[model samples]
Target: MRKAVLLALFSLGFISCVSVKNLPQNPSPYISKIDLVKGVKQEGERIVPVPFKGKIGENPVIFLILKNAEGKNRVKFRLYAGKTLREEYEISFGKPGEYYSRVIIWQGLKARKKGTYTLAIFLNESLLAIKKFRIEGLRQGP
Candidate 1:
C-alpha cells in the first residue's frame, strides 16, 4: 500500500512538471518596426501572437517588443477586454527586449463570446496605440 501511494505521488509530480504545448494565438502582436524620429517611438501595434493558438481553457501568453531611439526606455502597455478584463504590461527596452503576457478569464468570461476585444498599448499611461483581435474556434497547433 505504501509503495502504491509513493507511485501515485511520483506520477503526480511528473505530470505537474510536464510542460504544456500551446499554439501562437496569431497575427503576432508586436512592435513590428519603429520609425524613430529623434526620440523614443511612441508607436506600437497588436500583432498576432505567432506559432501558437492554444486550447480553449488554456491561458494565453503575450509578448511585446518595445522600440526606442537613441537610448533605452521605461514604458508600459495596457490591455483591456471588457469591464473585468485588464492587464498592465510593463517593459524596459534593451537589446532583444521582449515582454511576456498572459490572458485570464474575468467574471467567468471568454473573449470569443464577448464579441469585440481591445488591447490598448499606452506610453506613460496615455494612449499611444490600440489594436483589435477576434477570438474564434480556429486554434493554433499544440
Candidate 2:
C-alpha cells in the first residue's frame, strides 16, 4: 500500500509539469517585472507617469512594462483580435540598465478591434504571466 501511494503521488507531480504552449521560443530570456497600467498621465510638476487607476476598457492607453537585468530579455506578444491570434510581434528587449522597455498599446486602435484580448508575458521560455483586457472606446475629449 505504501508503494502504491508513492507511485500515485509521483505520477501526479510529473503530470503537473506539462509544458506551457504559449511561452517564448528562447531559452535564456529573463523578465524582471511586468505591470499593467492605465493611461499615462502628467502629475503636477512631473513628466508623464503611469496612471494609478482606470478600468481596462475605459482607459485611453495600456502599458505593457517589461523589465530585465541580463542581456537575454525578449518579448513575443500575440494580440488576439477576435477568435485567434490575429496579430503577433516579436521584439528583442534590451539589456536592463536604466529603462524597462515599455510596450504601449493604445486604445481605440483601428488595428485593435473590439473584443476580448489577452496579453501573455514569458520569461526564459516560460509562461510568466498573462493579462486579459478588453478594448473599448477612447476617453472622449481628452
Cα lDDT, model 1, residue 81:
65
TM-score of each: 0.36, 0.45
The alpha-carbon RMSD values of the candidates against the true structure, listed in the order shown, are: 18.9, 10.5
- Per-residue alpha-carbon lDDT of model 2 for 1-142, expressed as tens digits? 9999999999998988887779764433244444445445557854353654555544323344343334545555555655577655555645545443343322321234456777655554567566676766555575
Best by lDDT: 2
| lDDT per residue (tens digit) for residues 1-142 in model 1 | 9999999999998889977688655432335432211112223653333323333222233344443222334455455565445666566543345433332111111233533455666554556566555454434588
lDDT of each: 0.44, 0.52
RMSD of 1: 18.9
